[model samples]
Target: MKVLITGATGTIGSAILRHCLQEPSITSIVALSRRALPQDISSPKLSTILVSDFANYDAALLSKIASADAAIWAMGTTDANHEVNVIYPHTFFTTFLDARKNSEHRSKRFRYIRINGAFTVSDQDRSLWFFSEPRKLHGMSEARTLELGKQYRDVCQTFVVKPGGVATSGAGVMECAGKLFGDGAVIGAETLGAFVADLVVHGEEEEGAIFNKRMVEKGSALLKGNK
Candidate 1:
């Protein structure tokens, strides 16, 4: 199997790449990022493509994707300030769906996994008002989740991982504070990576499904037991 990973340098994304590289079934990998890949996990089967533009993707990228069987998209910005939170998540989901639609390897059914928030649901309205608006923006997240779920319904096998809070060895002090104080729990990136590898190799059906952190942890255990 060949895989394409976007935002391959992120905490969770990097973990997935590391685990996939060690999988004998994964013959090749293409990483898309704004900068060159870090040398920490270099391998012959892995290649990196630098891309800064997300809205207008270059057709040349299809060559790399042509050899891939799946894509793990981990590109999302955390800037909830301004209109970033509203825009970035929706854009990220659409880009992956659009890219799959235009790929030359359409013959190969592509499996796409995206990192989403745990609270995002498929149903509910979000038209609230006042200073409490930002707190209620979860409806925006949920709507985006449902939008992506619908867009990729039959086009690709989609998996939405709703992680609570990702824990990485390199996490900064601010992240640590949130992990300790926020309404979140720590989930190791390695565990998340392992699940990604299993999903790629096993070809599990997660289309329109939302797997929260606890669900993911339990699912991983169940998969391991079945294996």
Candidate 2:
């Protein structure tokens, strides 16, 4: 299957890309990023596209997107730039859905796995005390994407994954320890990547959003099943 990945150079995204590369079922990958990947990765199945603007997609980019069977949206920022975190993804779903309508793919459901942070309220309209606006924006983003998925249910299947503190090999010793002992609130980057990749390649049959602990459990099961 052909898979398109955004933010392919970020910690979680790079891990997902790695797993996808190792997966025999995935034949092609399109990596879209604002800048080129940090390291040169030589793989016949992998291709990179440098994008200057997330909101705008040129004809060439559109054509590439149309060819993909699934997409993983792992791009995000902590600066509270709602435009980047929220608006861009919503636009991508709309554009991809439009493109899918024109394409002649055999599968009716186009898989879209959106990587979201934990504690993001799906019901954005509800009030909250701490970090209210940012949480609401994040929730709104998920809600909007799910809305689009519902509107195009015949052609689109969206999955929102909410992972807590992500620990990576590159993290400092203290940070890694904190994440490891975070008690179900944290997950390793590799683990998250493998889980998301499995969902993209094998497809997650369960509908709606998935939380961190569930992700870990399901991902572990998938790994064992493969072995």
Candidate 3:
């Protein structure tokens, strides 16, 4: 399966990229970035596309990525603002669907995986103490994607993965703090990467929102299944 992935150069995105490279089931990978991927990474199965703007996609860009069976929006950062969190993904959601409009004959079910945080509150009226703005923005972003997924159920499916305490290699302090606070469970980058990769290659029957608890449970299971 060919997979289109954004933010393939970031931390979580790198983790996801590493696992996608290792998965034999995935035939090819298309990485979207503002710059080229690091020199350390290279593979015949991988191709990188330099994109200047995330909010807008030219016909050439859309056409290039339209063939992908799945897309993983692994973009966004800790201090991600409204444009990065909402506008980018929203634009992408609509643009990708437009990209595939011409290819209806060759269309297969497109699985779109969105990486979201666990504490995100979809309820706009609900109160949050910490990271309220970011959480709400992300929540709002996912809400819109879910709506599109429902609307295009025939041709596409969207799944939001709410992973908690993404413990990356050597990030002791951050990992520890993450685990101790919000989510007690710490999921390593490798495991989380493998988890999402499995979903795109094997495909999931259902889609919506997946919390940290389910992520840990299913991610672990998916990793083992890979072995």
* lDDT of model 3 at position 183: 46
- How would you order the candidates by TM-score, starting with the best? 3, 2, 1
The sequence of per-residue lDDT tens digits that candidate 3 reaches over residues 123-186 is 8888888888777878887788889889878778889888876877744454455556644356
Per-candidate TM-scores read 0.72, 0.87, 0.89
lDDT against the true structure, per candidate, is 0.64, 0.79, 0.80
Q: How many backbone collisions does model 1 have?
A: 0
Judge candidate 1 at residue 113 and give its lDDT: 71
Candidate 2 per-residue C-alpha lDDT over 106-207 given as tens digits, one digit per residue, 9 for 90 to 100:
356789989888867767668788877777778778788777778877887888888877877642342345447663477677778778888898776675
Mark the 10 consecutive residues where model 3 has the least summed lDDT: 170-179
- Candidate 2 clash pair list: none
- Model 3 scores what on Cα lDDT? 0.80
Clashing pairs in 1: none
Question: Candidate 2: minimum summed lDDT over ten consecutive residues — where?
Answer: 170-179
